[model samples]
Target chain A: MPAVAFTVVIALLANADIAFGQPPGGRPRPNLPPIPPKGDTTHTLTRDFVPASNTKSETAPHDNGFIQRWLALEPIRKEIQRNNILTETYIRTAFAENNFSTDFNVVPKNGRKVKVGDQRLQWHALDSKTFIFNLYNFTYAINKPPYGNIFWLVTVINCPEEIPNVRMAAGVNSGGMFWLNGEEALVLSGDRDMVVDNVVSQPLTLKKGKNIVRAAIINGPGMCTFAVRFLDENGSPVKNFTISYE
Target chain B: MKPTILTSLSILVMLATQTSAQIGQPFIHDPSTIVECDGKYYTFGTGGGGLISEDGWKWHGGAVRPGGGAAPDAMKIGDRYLVAYGATGGSSNHKGAIFTMWNKTLDPNSPDFKYSEPILVATSDGYEECDAIDPGLMLDPTTGKLWMSYGTYFGYSRMVELDPKTGGLAPGAEPVDVAIACEATAPAYHDGWYYLFATHGSCCDGPNSTYNIVVGRSKNVTGPFIDNVGRSMLEGGGKLVAATEGRLIGPGHFGRIIVEPGIEKMSLHYEADLDQGGRSVLAIRPLLWKNGWPVAGENIKAGTYVIQSERRGYALELAVDMVRMPVARWFNRSTDEPIKPVDTQKLEDVIGDWPSGNIDARIGDYMSRPHQKWNITPAPDSSGYLGAPYYKIVIEGTNRALAATADGKVITVPEFTGAPEQLWMIDQLTDGTYRIMPKQVPNSNEKLALISFGDSTPALGKFDVNSDNSKWSFRAP
Candidate 1:
């Protein structure tokens, strides 16, 4: 091993199996090692990272545990996307009034019914997952989110091992709601920054294989994207995972 | 007094202001016409008010505009400033009315700050095919008439002519359909080609917005503006100007600032900057004309760079004999040991090996050698060509500088003298390559073109028009 790799190993050993946030089943919390406050840029780039603390940050207050590739869906709400006659303020107002529960986690299993924006949707056999929704609008303009509007994308994660007492680490911009295995997980509403590992979810169970992850992302007429990864109980990345699109 | 953080910060801010006049502060949306009245620059935005810049940078909001609407355009018409905007348009307000007013001066402190009452120019009474919003103004150079283009994504984008003297509608002027398929249609005249620029795709969604500026040009100001590919603006045919790919997205409402003749910059509102919490902020980029069409270029930033020749991507270096530095390997070096910093090859180690004469320029494989790097610093006080500051390109960490010679050759001088030959003008081409031209050579009127003189030799000659051999790209090691 090179000196850089050796130093990284030593740092990992020094931080191994440390107990994190409280969770059921005594599983360690899935969280990231805290970085020093924003000013010390030099030290922050070093391998010996300090553990996280609950420092109040207006942009990224909380740290996410894991960040990995995810799939997204084409945006819905044709009424809003039509020449933008429905207007972004109208969709933003509806999202502000907390009216997006109807869009989250439409269908985890293939052939399940999901109702969204006066339309009933179900997972088709051809539905697939993508790496990210960063270019969903341009890549899928047919049903992509138009300017000044809102849309939803849901992804399914298939984990090999059951990740007990784990937290869903996500970086979401412009606010969104998350669901796991058809259960409501967290709601990050309001116009917020999408800092990496920005939000940590409450204790959740990632069963062996085929876990449904759904997101109803809302943008007030700008860029909207979400990054997510699974964290194991021991403040580390959960390995052996793939995603599904059905 | 000892230098503290506050004092050092103050010095940094002062230095920054003197270097770049049109950057580094004031995030705004839908900015109005940027005009220099006295020594200060002023612009009105949406939301009824405006911002004032004392030194062309570091803006603060104190000025005001009438109508309190969105996407306002202000023009200096003779002795007064003509301002136009949409009154009730908010994406889908077809009932919105176009309004205009006049003010003598933009400064609120000026005695001539009073604005005339808002006069209705046009209106879309909620039932028309177009929603009257997002207006842009232009003064026809040939006809000396004022024209405004206004509409929304609701339907047709239309243009109407006005009398320049009174800012009133011209006789027999009706709304003529100019462009469709986009919003924020702005008209401009350049070299007999009347250009129409419009913002395409989604806006207001922060990072998700995909706003880009597209353009079409015409020989006449009014009808049938066409793109380079011969697509009409009325038929959704537009050539792209600025689009998303980098950190900023949804650039809309094109504004032009003329920095002397042949030099210009374009201003627009990026719907969301991913780094700035998705807030709509102002952005100004270098606007250069290529093939008779205006294209945006990158802002020059101070940095160290590995100047690479565009043809073969070989790095530029001092024409000196190569001495391979010995690489030492320690048998006892263990992986468990902490890493130590290694000293980079210094200039002194190679300076003695170089010929004691005028050093020429060459292209070679990058070896992180001291001769392969250059430092580019913005020379703002000294004037160069249009719309850009002259730059001083010096050998990294050394006094040896690159200069263009009278005989169409490049040589490294011992020190920078701020001479015309030592000043380099860099402009980015539409394909993102930078063409660097020296200020002047003894009797030549062309730029320094870097070309291959055999296999590995890089020689300089007069620039060949639209030649790839003349462009270079910078890669930082």
Candidate 2:
């Protein structure tokens, strides 16, 4: 472990983009007035990656629910799963060409296969930095590509018994589609953040026993994350049920 | 003396020294300080969830940290525990805010465990060059004032003063920029220096993640912090503290606990562990000082041990000369005497020969008697210094405790009193032997450290870390 830690320190010292010991001697921002420790303008090291500040699978309570326990899979490109079918084509596009889409009806069938019991799915459990299943860094485990794309995240909600009017609120990165039991419950296609249940405006009704939630997340070139929760009519989190991947 | 509070260092070491670290369960991100409440250990993580351990060695998910956003930190102010966390401050949710609440206990089931309403301490408008996330809390030992450091790489890391009593911002307090080029800012104080430890580099990349810990020190809680090179932290000056462990990447979120005068431990989370399916887990490492700068020391390996007093090389024994009754042997079958359960040595059996108040703690031959045999276990639950946990020394096969009396004498108490006299901070010296000190010595500021008297008698004396009189080795009996 000491050897590994030392190697990282040395490699960081060797990287010019991330000059560790350099003094703050550079240009200033045009719009934002210079802040403290002036003379510093640009720092790519600070912009390297967005710390997944809220890495919780289940965020705090709100007027309604909580988003927790998600079993995410590695990131998969959007080309093949457009319009609910595998449409493979020659493409060298990156985040600048953020034109990507995923249809719940379409099954990409090919990516990193995850073993869920005896069944194998196109996506596998994303190695999350926290138990919350952070998707932004979750994708780095698969590949380094344009941040904006599509991901097929799968999670199983174990409802002890049948319930009526259990409102489902969700937060998705950028935007895309949401499915409950293979049925399209909501369609969000745009740029956005995973705001602990950002989709409360469009509430969802869930069935009891095993409820399958599949998120077709689309990002333009930034973080890819999502959260969902169940709530009662009063907007308090309905936590009697368990959130599981199995 | 009133029982001293259990510091974070001692509690973490209780399990760290004896067991292989179990960072896998509950699989939390950014775990909070390991705390001992109600004789058990508990810690909160991101996602409004946390973990608990009956023994420091095995942790499972069950703790509840209400209102969890990201990278939360916790500290006890008085009888209550105050937890602070970032509500939102990310690429998507840029308008970040730090929230805090206090609960008497980490357990939601406890009757005294009601959490106060969340209080807003600070906030950051995404465009303000500071994103208020990953808040780490510190209660200034010098002034008793509360301070919190919150921010991410999106902008500058800043420290905000908080009301120690209310878990809110102190009057007229404002966020002050302390560091940048990192996130999860933790403020730790040693001697006269307040060390600002933070995370640098890209995190959350599984095995590919390059997250490492860096540190800077300042004289005041708020500062113009500088690194070992004398470069300012405000200008990205930080000395490297720790980084990756081969396939393990991203060691972020710094938590410091002092076990003794010279021993400290740093706690953090590994962004990803290749050995654990790239899953994230909590990690604790010994914090060592070199030339006044703090660095991580080597990991500890567990071994069976016989704890002996350093003074005269005598093993810690029970107050009872008390006898170890012989079990029935084939040759001396007790069938003629009617078989019955045998009793361990009792205080009454040896009380007549010893002093009236404090039993004489003397050195006897290494006979490996049940009373002579001793097992040294980590008791993070016990009070200690630096980041190491104090040890619970019990007579093997019995509960009689070895305690240091107010008169600076070592004796065996009848039972485990859980008092300052019984709680001992055992420090391993340079030569591998140890100096055991009581957490408190009645009302005195001086620590009652175990020493070898001229006659090989066990007693307490003033401590000098380098003295051989206070050092004892742990041997395998």
Candidate 3:
């Protein structure tokens, strides 16, 4: 009877580990370098973002053309210089050499685990209720240090019809790179605050089908955030499309 | 009209000017035009935070504005709200930047509530002639173009165009000098004329502030705005719109709110409400347009008045059998005898004659009868609309209350139950006449005003500003 009770307890513990996407023994910790202490802790993490109320796990762009839904992978520790030495050359070279994923076009499933460098990170589906995504809050929410890390976000936009002459408008803090359908579309490399439509890509066409948008945001110190949207030739928001974490 | 009754109404008006202000914590400076969102009203002031009201009358502070700036203006465009404010400027330094942002919802608790990062639209260096503060936003109803007027007493007031879609500066749009010697400038359009409303004189001086609202009109949004007498606003010519009234001194920052077609209200702040400890407080008054120019209208005060229909020179009265007065046999009496004043018809003399049920109302000759005398008093415990409280129109000395029936008719009920149908909104129209509307019509959301359907008939109907049938005047009996 004591042996049977011990077996039952073992089964329950195994089920709990499986529920958290961990192996039976335990999840492996990321074998990454130690993270330095955060420089600033005075930032009032305003609970501005809320979970999207989409029942079908899909969302839409904001009325002002801001994309608010994304599937984010857990941050991977990275060495970054202070004083915003993050320039165009530094960011492009960093993103080019690091193979974060096997295929950029593939939209990772939420709760799925991925191995980047020596770190094993899980993917999460998040809906930013605000125009700008607060990366500090996002990292803190996932129990990870917000600074000195790289965050990878992916979203699938389903267009109703083929759209022409639409430009990708984006703003990001620190530095970031954007990809559309596995092709580099825009790169924002600077230490700056997020301003709406701060950098707009040249006019591009959106095919009448699912389009994958992926981004990698790198922050060395201070706050990190990003917002992206599509504007038509007339500069109005392209809101006819739907967003989902597929 | 009796001289004594006129004197009473005059006193009431004087008292209202000194006492009637927005209730609750309505303290604000340079309040923007009040905007309604999801049935709630919000108005942002000069500082950062603003006031929100479930009902327009009672205001308290819970509104949120991200950028702490001076003179913010808010407007709703499509499904989004655009907010523009000046970032910096004061008596010492005039260097400032005006920014615009978009928000999904003004209520902070809303799931979609978030403001787009503010984009700088206009700026001014201290060395420049103009200060880029005091941003007043106006969307041209005709062209769908958003325009902003900004500046201060430090330099020229200027107008610029903004992208209505992005809340950014319009492509290559330059600021055009519109007016000088004024700040807190706002633009309004009426009857094909674009009017530039601005605050003139000193501000932030409490009771001693010389601030007054003045305006000039032009045919174009990019205007050489001209006053009524053909003086250009660029030359500092502005027709006076509002000035110091009673204890509320320094009326500045004019914001116009159209309650309905014929009813409008102007929102401003009294630099010092002596009654409110000389603190700047929000005040809303009826906006009356006279001779193609806008002027501040008085809020109707609580008093006994004879409601006369403008359609016909007849009075609103209960449709009851006329009671006979005591016969003095004056035909045989001589003029030489000492005369005693004839007391007015008392409510007791005729209320017993009226049916205990609802009495239909009509327009008839007013003989100062008790039924024709309406005692309009602010209904207690009622959250009022916009600028004034909902009033209870009752017989002078009884509970017979004026109410709107489910059917499109006006009647006097036996008692004032404080029901929505019994509450009345008496708005002073632009023509100085009044349109009496119920707080709500029974079984319908349609807003109907008391109209003289015929010379002898009174009914609830659509308010037509051009027709005298929709107008009623409150006269002293």
In terms of TM-score, the best-performing candidate is 3
lDDT, candidate 3, A102-142, per-residue tens: 47799888788988888899887778866667676677666
Q: Which stretches of candidate 1 lie over 4 Å from their true place?
A: A1-246, B1-25, B306-348, B351-372, B377-394, B397-477
Residue B252 in model 3: shift from native, Å? 1.0
Candidate that beats the other on TM-score, 2 or 3, i.e. the better one: 3
Give lDDT tens digits, candidate 1, residues B207-252.
5555678889988778798887675776455788898747787788
Reference-based TM-score, model 1: 0.50
Tens-place lDDT per residue, model 2, A106-156, is 332223465433434444432233213345445434344534455656666
Native contacts retained, all candidates in order: 0.00, 0.00, 0.00
Clashes of 2: 24
Model 3 residue runs over 4 Å out of place are A1-246, B1-25, B324-343
TM-score ranking, high to low: 3, 1, 2
Between prediction 1 and prediction 3, which has the larger TM-score? 3
- True-vs-predicted CA distance for residue A245, candidate 1, Å: 38
Relative to the true structure, candidate 2 has a C-alpha RMSD (angstroms) of 21.9
